[model samples]
Target: MTTQNLLVELFVEELPPKALQKLGNAFANVLFDQLKVRGLTAADSVVTFFASPRRLAAHVTNVLERAADKDVLVKLMPVAVAIKDGKPTDALRKKLANEGRAHLADLWPNAVDGPDSLVVQSDGKADAVYLRGIAIGGTLQVGLEFALNEAIAKLPIPKVMSYQLETDCELPGWTSVNFVRPAHGLVALHGSTVVAVKALGLTAGNSTQGHRFEAVVSPVVLQDADSYAATLRKDGAVIASFAERKAEIARQLAAAAAKVGNGARPIEDEALLDEVTALVERPNVVICQFEEQFLGVPQECLILTMKANQKYFPLLDAAGKLTNKFLVVSNISPEDTIFVTGGNERVVRPRLADAKFFFDQDRKKTLASRVEGLGKVVYHNKLGTQGERVERVRAIAKAIASQLGDAQLVQDADLAAQLAKTDLVTDMVGEFPELQGIMGGYYALNDGLGETVANAIEDHYKPRFAGDALPRNTAGVVVALADKLETLVGMFGIGNLPTGDRDPFALRRHALGVIRMLVEKDLPLDLNALLAGAVPAFGDKITDASAQLADFIYDRLAGSLREQGYSAQEVDAVLALRPQRLALVEKQLAAVRAFAALPESPALAAANKRVGNILKKAEVEGPVDAHVNPELLQEKAEQDLFAALQRFVPEANAQFDAGDYTASLQTLAVLRAPVDAFFDDVMVNAEQLDVRMNRLGLLKMLHNAMNRVADLSRLAV
Candidate 1:
């Protein structure tokens, strides 16, 4: 088989900016994978993808012109029906005909003698025969067409557009096709020879349009697969590669920001950058400015409006504050820059004015004034209105604060929780839901509320995403934790538990938020107790899902701990205890890991496991006595182990009480030798009932001492 580089392009109308990259990647990868499946490319073949506002393209190297021939076994009907008198029968002929191998029907040989024979009956008779045949390879024309159709079918289109295409000479009427956008042209080249493939009612060709406005020719003809990118850059005046275009835009953004001096730089938002890159073909960054008075609004407001509405980059100063000047990525470069800059400035002024208007009007009333408005906003059909939800949150927060600190902290948390959702009705937040907590903080300050309360109101929604910062103070922490718990417990209570990927309320994220607060902040709250307290706040609207909620939180904690570099065995051992104080989980896990590394760890862990199994089996008759009768320690090994536990357990308990978990576990390591000996020589299930119960009691006492920090049995290999 001969091999060459392959290029494929699908030209269309403007694609959805947010979905362009995903669509391009899906198109390229699916096509490449299909080729590999069809034996047209090797596993090591390289594929490069290109995506812009108007096209999706892929360049694959080492693609074969024809897939190599292979021997494919095609099964025929079984023995009794396939052959008669050592010759093929009618049923086998029909099977071969259906497979397009009727001509080879007579060539099938006679059946052999035994189990390895081709002939064997269903009932153990020597009459069944199975025939097989080989299939030939496919050509590039057939394979490429199949791959193109399959790739298009698998494109991850956010929305599909239906359009009618003029029929080819062979088909006279119109044909309707659904795609991400209306298809305009397609280019598929295999080392300068156009692959015979058709898609979206168009035949494959070696030409495509580039930079609708800057192209030197209407349709720039690609000479070969290797010349596509360079030709598009030179004559078509377009950067065909998405990555190259993005990098170029970054370079221009930096250069434009630098021209302003004073340590100014473009706002760093990768999502915004990608979206802007997708909206342009030939990017030309132009510096524009708005009235400095607009900066009076919050920088977040200005930055969001500029990036979201105008698709511009707002430059920031050395202090990371938004400046008046911004950069625009223009698709065309005009000789007179004033027209372009002035036009952009004119277009953005109204957007800024709207943001400023919302800001000014939102400050007219105190957050407390918006409290009653929440009564009309339904939180959930079964969970009542936002006003009702606010009451629940306030109660949970107050209880948490009372536990964490004094009356002042409780009062502050109460006020913050009460006003947290008030901003949802504010003009600024209503216009931009992303500004909910931020707007509340600003309004609180304007109402003469102290910074502590203002910050609490703002940060109650902190750590909204993975790696996001937590609440700034104790009051904020209390309210934030309460809010997340209420959501989790309420959702789980009403049978709204998340199933698969359908968590409409982001319950998974809320669960993770709680875990992050508990483990990362090292909060002293009991996880089970928190859930228990939260369930009551929902009143009759929710069931007691406290137990289920705790399990969910622990599962999230286990996954999160593993992600942070703890091994599965280490995590299982620590979490097996279901320690109520999650803040100490990491410490316990650390101790477990340290203990597992000891020289005697393996023997001790196995013995611990053995002791646990014995206790479980012995408990079926009745509860095993925890009180070990020392007088019944008949064996020397048992006596030695009992003596070791009496001496070492207290020292370990003392270190554990002192918060030196590592020391506590290390102290227990001293009993490993005696534990091994006891399990080796002593029969825990003795002939005498009293002696057996006493031995079981000794094992129970040792198990309790060994597992205070972690379940050592879980560490056994």
Candidate 2:
């Protein structure tokens, strides 16, 4: 069988920039998969996908014109049901007729082995009659048609648009077609031959429109499958491949930034780069500038405005300070870029001016005054207004700070927490909600509240997402913890827990944020105590759901640790203890891992599991005390185990107290021999009541000492 390269393209209106990359990949991948499924692709076939503002295309190598015929064996029915007295029954005849093989019913008796044959085989339950036949292969036109339909149906369209197709006079009526964009043309070629395929009411062709303005040709005619990208680039004035176009834009941005010289470079934002790449076919990087007065505004605000509003890249200096100069990725590459640069600069000046104006107007009223406005802004209907939420957060922050810091730290934390939501009412933040906490920080400094308070106000929302940085100062840490805990406790209290993937409040993110601050900051705060402390702030507004909230946080912590590459068993053992200080969890996991590697681990773990089971059963009768009577030690094995505990338990306890978890677990490793010997030689449930209780007590002591770091019983399997 001979194979040839294949090219398929869909020409349409501009696509959604944010979803273009994903849509392009999905389209090409689905097409290739459908081809492979239909056996239209060769074993060594490879596919390359292209995405641009106006089109999505794919080129596949080693594609076959038709799929080869395949030998197929299909189970018809059970042998007992199909054959009666060594002859075909009515049921078998009807089955053959329905399958369009009615002649096979007559040929079944004499023809036992051939291209079309019936054989008996067991289908794991009963013997079944199998129909062996050579399935006819599919032609390229039909296979390609199926593949095109499947690919179009499976595209990850963010939103679909419905448009009416223009009909010929013979057709007379309008037809509605839905797609991401109004598709104009579709190209499907097998080498130089056009494949008979249609999608979204358009027939396959060899020509497609290219760049809207700069194309040298109105419709670029592709000579062969391999010439798609080259022809588009030369005659159509378009770079067809999304990745190549993006890389070209980046290279030009770098070159333009270098020309501006002063150690300047474009702000690095992959999302913005991708969006800009999806908006243009051929990119022309142009440098534009604004007045330096806008620099007085926060760089974040200005940078965000330029990138988000204008899709421009703000240049940053060596010190990572935003510069007046910014780069624009334009679709048209005119010889003289002055008009383009001037137009972009003129357009951005008003946006920057608006940000500066909002900033200046916002600073006129200090954050303290804006605190009154938050009462009108709703945070949650059930929870309360932002004003009420602020008070709760302040109370929680004070409680947390009092435990971790001095009177000054508590005061700063309270101030920061009170003013944290005040900026939600500011004009700047109202316009750009992303700058809520950020604008508060600026207002704090403007009010002469000092850098400590300003930093806390800003950093209170730290770690807004995964891997984000935590608060910078002690006050910030205290306030951040309080803010996150208040949300978790309040939401869980009101029964607005996250179900499946629908977390409208982002409760999971809030829980992880709380866990990150507690564990990473290593605040000497007890998990239960912190949750309890947050409850009083809510008063009667929420139920005391601290117990459920603690479990939620621990679950989040366990998941996070596993993602960090610890095995499930290790995470389970450490988290099983529900260690109060999450900071110690990693160390505890490390210790558990070390102990599991010991030659004595398996036997010891098994013995520990056995002891736990025995203790559980003994406790059903009465509470078993850890106090073992030395005089009650009758068996030699029991005597030896008690002596070993006396020798090692003290040292292990000391290491545990000193925070050396690894050393402590290793110290207990020496008792494995004695423990195994005791389990092997002694009868735990003796006939005598005193003897049984004493044995249970000895096991209880062993269980307590072994589980200080982590429950070894979890490692038993």
Candidate 3:
């Protein structure tokens, strides 16, 4: 086996910064998958990736030396059937006769072969000859290129523009392969040598740039890929890794802040650091301070302006208050200057001043007064307006909250919901869309709304993504559930439900958010019952969508519980009980498992199985109200069994009332001994008509008692 090192580089014109990380990740995974799929297994390996605004790189160490030479007996379905008894069929005969091969039996007769062996396949299974024809040997290079190109075609990108039209390019640049952004050239190398890349509309070359502003125009020579990266850094670029860049930014921010009297503390924003890292080759950090007057503006507005507009990092005091100073990380070297510090401050000052104006203007009106403005703002085209959506949410929340025992919070949540969307009309939120909910809470509080109302405004949007924080208070939980339920019911009603991978409305997300609230919050709300409550709120607006809405919510519950390690079948079994309370379902599941594990479980199930089989066959007439005549109960064991049934019934009901299914199951277990004794001592189908009917009635009672915890027939343990 000969192992050859390979490198593929795409040195492109400014690619979209966002696409850099995704594209690099996609390439490594796809390439690794494609190569390994060819039956070549790596002994051990590690893969690391690098990307910047204009470049993407991947390095793999100790990969498979070469693809294993694949050869196996290729099986075909019914290989002999193809030959039709000992001879080929007419079509097969003609082909074989043309080749002068005669019947395959003639070459080595099946009836008269020396070793008494012939390969015959059943009609349902494969045969060797046919499978052999399609088994092309697994070769590394040809297959790798094909796999790489297929994946590259599917990579997601934005702002694609292309040139260099090729007549036969798989996707010609002008109409075919558009880069995430425009491309200048490509460089793919194996160790120190250039490999094929233009088939991908990329040139395989030894040359690449160090930095757009710093390096010379002539192509920089590289002895090896690793040296190429080292040279680029020496020439002025910090292109090692994303993690390295992020760490460097943090290091500089901390050092610079320490020089100040109170020093600086890093605010956590790995995402922000990542984006700035892409825009530069080498990183340099500068600290600047805004006027103290700017702190009067909402901290979110300050954050939005710095992170979004200027790509600057905001500083915070140890108390978590926003300080006037912010950090601006530049990609250029210090000598390049490039107006790096001054230019950033120029952009931030105007944004800061605009925010201050909105803050002052919003305080002029109370939040209650602004609730009327939501009517003018459309929430959905068919749904009337934001105010209308809030009306529906308020009704739904109040109804759900009343059941959950948070009636007081419900009222406050309703008030919060009433005014939640009004802030979208605010100048602050209008200019900074991400600030919608956050600013609403701020403005509502400033307008003299109570803490509960302000919190509900913000909490309603809690858990913006999976694993994100849920609402911290009961009022927040109430409003959040109401808001998501409204969205889900509305979307399904409109026939705009998520299908396949498309969920433009993010219905699944909303359902997940709702599920998390009910379960983790222990809201004492059953999803099914809560869903039923929400239906009246949707009113005639969404009658047909009700079943679809319920199913979607249950599916989300299945996913959420499955993540917690419950199997789909177990969840299905518990849900089959039609639990109206989530807490009850959880309790029942715990009880059932404890009961199911008992030694008595299989035996009771056996008795119930016998009862079900007999009841099914006899078609026992008219709920046989046969009273056992003790004189007719000629068998002593029969009399003994009656005594046991009398004892079991009362305690069973008591256990169920106490919600002690484990004890209920234990109570049922008591009947097993009597059932076994009666079956052993006497035949149930006695000769006397009244005696047989009485016996069957007794068995029927046992079956009814066992069905209470779960369908025991399902437990055929």
Best of the candidates, TM-score: 2
Error of 1 at 602 (Å): 2.0
Query: How high is the lDDT of residue 560 in model 2?
Result: 94
Q: How many clashes (backbone atoms < 3 Å, residues ≥3 apart in a chain or on different chains) does model 3 have?
A: 6
Q: What's the lDDT of the predicted structure labeled candidate 1?
A: 0.89
User: Tens digits of per-residue lDDT for model 2 on 1-717?
Assistant: 999999999999999999999988998999999999989998889999999999999999998998999999889999889999988999999987787676787876664545787778899999998888888889888988898888889999999999999775696899899999999999999999999798888899999998899999988899999999999999999999999999999999999999999999999999999999999999999989999999999998999899889999999999999999999999999999999989999999999999999999988888889889889988998988989999999999999999998999999999999998898888898889998788889889999999999999999988899989999999999988888888899999999899988999888898898888888888898899989988988889889988998898888898999999999999998999999998888889999999999998898888888889988887887899999999999999999999999999999999999999999999999998899899889999899989988988999999999999998999998
Q: Rank the candidates by lDDT, best first.
A: 2, 1, 3
Residue pairs with backbone overlap in model 1: 79-128, 79-129, 80-128, 119-128, 120-128
Which pairs clash in model 3?
A: 7-189, 75-127, 76-126, 76-127, 77-126, 238-281
Model 2 residue pairs with clashes: none
Q: Give the alpha carbon lDDT tens digit for every residue of 83-177 in model 3.
A: 66655456544444454333543553342223222345443545523221123445444655665575566667665565554555576445466
State residue 331's C-alpha deviation in candidate 2, in Å. 0.3
Ranking 1 against 3 by lDDT, winner: 1
Which stretches of model 2 miss by more than 4 angstroms? 112-114
Off by over 4 Å in 1: 77-85, 103-134, 169-172
